[model samples]
Target: MNPSAWPAPAAAVANTLLVNPTIASRASARFPLALLNLAAALDRNGASRIIDGNLDRGFIDTALDALAQTRFDALGISVMGGPQVAPAIALSRAVRERFPQLPIVWGGYFPTLYPDTALNADYVDYAIRGQGERTLPELIAALRGEGPPPAQIQGLSWKLDGAPVHNPDRDFSSDDAPPLLPYAKLGDPRRYLAPTFLGRRTAVHQAALGCRFRCTFCGVAAMFGGATALPAAQRLARELGYLKHGLGADSVQFFDHNFFDREADMIPLLEVMARLELPWWCYARADALLNLSPATWTLVRKSRLRMAYIGAESPNGAMLKEIRKGTRPDQTLEVAELCRRHGVIPELSFMVAPPHDTEAATEQTFEFIREIKRINPQSEIIVYIYTPLPEASRHRKDRGKRAAAPLLDLRGEPVVFPDTPEQWTQQRWVDYACHADAPWLSDDLRRRIRDFVTVLRCRYPTVQDLRSPRWAKRGLSAMAAWRYRLRRYDRPWELDLADRLVRLRRPQASGL
Candidate 1:
């Protein structure tokens, strides 16, 4: 239907109900920035409300109740492709059953990576790929009979005659000066803030959108297609000031895909952070931190940069290059030492157990992690199995070009990816998405990885574990020292017993 032929806004202002399906525990939950941004855009021409499942355990019922009380034009569910897929499916099914007429749209990494699969389910009506700030409002307008038909909406995938129809991908929006996120929509925003290693009452913000790097294995690359935009300095100051002075957030966590971009582009933002000095944590690339000038380093220090999560994916330079990670192993080591000198904890993550040379690669990475710890004992280590994205899951621009070598299972069978959201919710696929396990990892290798991780973490207890008593950490460190030094990472049943009693937090699973 032509937009001109549709009813006027006076007849109905499109109202949307946005939901972020449960992805984290209540204590680990941060502000739902994606939904907030979408809400801001929706409010520009219509009305929208947010439901973060992380904080609300009974979110499915709450969403239904909200829909019952209000005339919501559509329901937008934000889904990621791991454990979140299950809750998202449940919520989508519940909403579909109750509000049969209301349109249900799925967005975020899950749909962006597998739009067809997302739309395969009977519950999900439309899948919004890429940035939804623009596509969402436009989709809602079209659904409300106020705009063009579904085929004309870019970044939208919908079913036509029971078949998924994917429109041309949308260009990355210039979010240099986005509208202030409607945090007020989430009543009592203080509930979103939580204590972290950075400071008490740490709030989360995203100063940049997307990431420039196109690492073959990274979900960010598939979502953004190597596009990124940093916020304006004024916008950063305004938002940070409000987060600090207005909401009493003692610290901030910048959830930018890659926080430290080019040095020249980062100086202004760093200056604003320095002025605020609100202790911050962020995701950074090893090359970016290593290339920063001394002056820029001073600003970073003055800004109270507490921790930087660097993806040191592998110890082998060949594997790093094969994955197009952009940074090398030496750079990872250098950044560890550099972060140590700058008083920033380098939370380094390594992806071990590749499809080929699974055991040898895993052993190499363990040794490399030891070298990093020797350089800086304060360096926090995160280990994950190397699970590359399926060729079909790559962004359209990247698909079929430099495709990943075919994956093989232990029996030399081809590794097949799930073709539906329900399949993705299966334990094996969920493990693949989370980078926790893979099809090719043998039982012995998996146990070895677990044992090594247990010993390594016990030896160097992460400072991020605020719940575990310091005395327990010290005692665990003392107990694990011999195993760590001797490289005897066999099943440490005693350490396992003690760890069960202590219940140390896994920072990789629940970020600060």
Candidate 2:
């Protein structure tokens, strides 16, 4: 709030608990606020100086070493983006090495993703799966011999006599969860890769968890056991207090699986929040948004609901049915119209070539995006390749020489299918840009979609005057599609089309 009075540079004081692994922090732009805020909570409850290792090169071992020079009585850790498991284990080892007597605690998404992997990590003395504001401090108190034993703590995990012990966990869906720490007051995103687009400017709020729908390709469902909404009005007010007061951020983003999933819980909270002035963004399922009439959506809009990420996975009913998206084509379209009426940009996050996708079916999806933009050129849509993932699909187990991970090759063809996986991923992201209305682009692909667009502008008006950029966009996208055609059994005809299309298109640019 001042030219000279900025927040002070953070320094290390005693009793600090090193937080989050920096290795896998690049997933989003928002770094380790959870640890910083938790430190605040601990300080609010009675603890001193919390340092975020997530934004620092402070790995677990680094934190453990830092602990050696100072006298921090208790240790705490937060995790996410399952990749940090290795570094966390290494940190645990250091904690054991440097402070065998100090108590250690761990929590976050990875533990949420794989408690067994987390529980098994030898370095982790204990793990707390969900919402640790209350549980973590109690564990510290117990360690300090100041409060109830570990068993009484709501979300506790520990090792006794070399065996993992989990206290009967408490259900947190009803819990208000420590108010979202002030986003403005937290550590940097160069730490953890959750969501950085809004960077430190936007507040990330949760309206609900446990997506009621069962979509296998989704990381949210697999990462969290299921969806559960936060409690109604009063509880919602309390959490908002954290975003408004603790963080001093006015702009907000709800990180719910479906912001409108429960009208009973949502309407009251929104009505209350409407009294406060702020811009907000949210994600939603198409059917639920459609359930809100044009008038209700208008109210949501008047309340500063600026944009929404809607799941319109496919244009085909069969594709939608196959993924069990639980919405009809008509319903998705209705929501699209409603979004425009409310003046909220609907960024349709679409899926193509899902396990059930066919080339014909995908073309129809392109048409669907075209229709939305045709009605309103401002209609933004984004598409993603429905690449198979190992997270939660029934196809999770592959006994063969697969590396237990899906390493995305944005440039190469997909080897798994040998015939077309590469082309499919490329198209999906292109379609996503079209779907999100952000800008259809795929820099990772060997074929340049943006360049393809530049070439198309010769026949088409630039995107500003784009008379349905989708169709012309299709012509350019087909260049990569043709490449996939060649890979289909390495046939001669497919090869000729790939060569011919590139050859034919290469010179037209010179005339333009």
Best by lDDT: 1
Cα shift from native, residue 472, model 1 (Å) = 0.8
**Clash totals in order:** 0, 25
lDDT of each: 0.90, 0.54
Candidate 2 stretches greater than 4 Å from native = 1-18, 23-33, 36-49, 57-66, 82-97, 100-104, 134-169, 176-201, 207-210, 214-219, 222-227, 231-250, 316-324, 356-367, 385-512
Residue 440, model 1: lDDT of 96
- Residue-level lDDT of model 1, residues 175-227, one tens digit each, is 52455778899999999889888888899999888899898998899988999
**Residue 285 lDDT (model 2):** 76
Collision pairs in model 1: none
TM-score each candidate.
0.97, 0.62
